[model samples]
Target: MGSCEVYPQTIQHSPNGRFVVVCGDGEYIIYTAMALRNKSYGSAQEFVWAHDSSQYAIREGNSVVKIFKNFKEKKTFKPGFGADCIFGGFLLGVRSNSGLAFYGWETSDLIRRVEILPKHIFWSDSGELVCIATEESFFVLRFLMERVTTAQESREMLTEDGIEDAFEVLGEVQEVVKTGLWVGDCFIYTSSVNRLNYYVGGEIITIAHLDRTMYLLGYIPKDDRLYLGDKELNIISYSLLLSVLEYETAVMRKDFNTADRVLPTIPLEQRTRPLSVMLFKNNCLISVLLNYLTRLSILLQFSGEQIV
Candidate 1:
């Protein structure tokens, strides 16, 4: 509804939606998104927001990196040698020669290092897990943020190696993840094959194969739906559930104990799709037939016709 003093080349809103930034002509302004007041300003070649959106980084003067907390400059330093890219979040991430290395925002000390080729990094809303999308695949990791942050704040003793203990790479999925979002322990992504899938505990299960490129925008737990935007900018949504995701993951892993336990706990109406997904997985002919029968029974139950 208004114009800016400087025409913006790019505009980005924080993940938290509290702040908005506009960059143009090597200068930037951070504004309170609602009231549109300029709270922070600086000159930098690049501007990147952190995971929580409370902090951000700006690259200026060659290798120099600056971090701003709550719209105020907090720290400035140089990324270590072999580091090529900067990603600010729960930690200051730099792509190094071997892998990704994280540093504390205040002390700039090494928090942990991960060995992987990362093209994009997505941290979960809860900040407990992170998904690193590589050239051809994607992987997840458990970041011990509390532990690492405590070590930084208390200056506690670390092992001689000092890292290795702070993070664990869960595993990688070779699916070409185009774009995705994380909800709790599940990662919902659209693949290169035009399929929507969710990953959990190293296994992936298909949700649908709509032949359109979709980007995950948000998930509403109360309504049990995911809002997505397609290439044409049309908004679409689909029903999803966390319990169903967990049950399907357990089933894909062939953990019958877990699958059987979680199956009945799912809302009755949502049970069919989870089982239908398994029918096409790597299961054999006999398993497929059995799953087929199970689907029929679920349908009958849905129609209020009990299976005799």
Candidate 2:
């Protein structure tokens, strides 16, 4: 807010990098980042930015989260009880001491209610999936948004009782996730044990091992590379093809039709990349996965180049 004298509890930058929000002391002020000029100010306890950055939300003293679209108040409603943290975006999400609840942005209907307290939540790039990270494990769920009208709200199909069937559990891992995000249908993460792995179709595979702890910055789809940074100010990258993972997932799901369509799309050199060590050691899943991969004539050996 133009370098105001008041100290803020936290500063939030919009996803599009156009606006900045300063929040503290039960209020927030918006500013145009480039001009360093104040745009608007409002009362709030907590603030969140929507996915597209076209709208924003704030938790008010009314115990409700308010959505502001184009600087005009559009929606406001209280989430499930005990929800203390706002994680709003394309969907309205709030986290409490015991669980997390989500609501539809347009109808304010309960979309999901889960009993797991998460340390981090990741929405897929296209908003088709979401990954919830807990202290002991992480799980992925597909996000479903169905358009409904008030006339259909009371129907048995569109009850406010929450859409449990829509948010399907894609996969889950017992390992603690340090950092990660989604790339296509696969979720790649750095585990607490310093192992980089990808989870798809209920299978977990270790693709690389980190000699030292590092953080995953992001993946560059154009370059087909994954970038990681360390506390020592060093940046490293690795070749991670998006199409290859997609093909693997399709095969795991037994969707040969999708696999056939995706296989030819991968580049020639990237097509033969080595398969990683799958997590079959933990349980009886090894024999099944091993026999499955063996059927793939393309995968004979496994070895990947490590970047230091």
Using TM-score, give the best candidate's number: 1
Q: Which residue ranges in model 1 land beyond 4 Å of their true spot?
A: 4-10, 96-98, 146-162, 246-265, 272-308
CA deviation > 4 Å runs, candidate 2: 1-13, 20-37, 146-154, 157-161, 231-233, 253-258, 264-308
| Global Cα RMSD, each model | 5.1, 6.2
lDDT at position 235, candidate 2: 96
TM-score per model over all chains: 0.76, 0.74
**Model 1 pairs in collision:** none
For model 2, where is the 10-residue window of minimal lDDT? Answer: 299-308
**What is the C-alpha RMSD, rounded to one decimal, of candidate 1?**
5.1
User: Model 1 misses residue 50 by how many Å?
Assistant: 3.1
Question: Highest lDDT among the candidates is held by which one?
Answer: 2
Local lDDT at 269 for model 1: 69
lDDT of 2 by residue, 192-228 (tens): 9999988876777677899999899889988889999
Q: How far is 53's C-alpha from truth in model 1 (Å)?
A: 3.4
Model 2 error, position 291 (Å):
18
State in Å the error of residue 149, model 1. Answer: 5.7
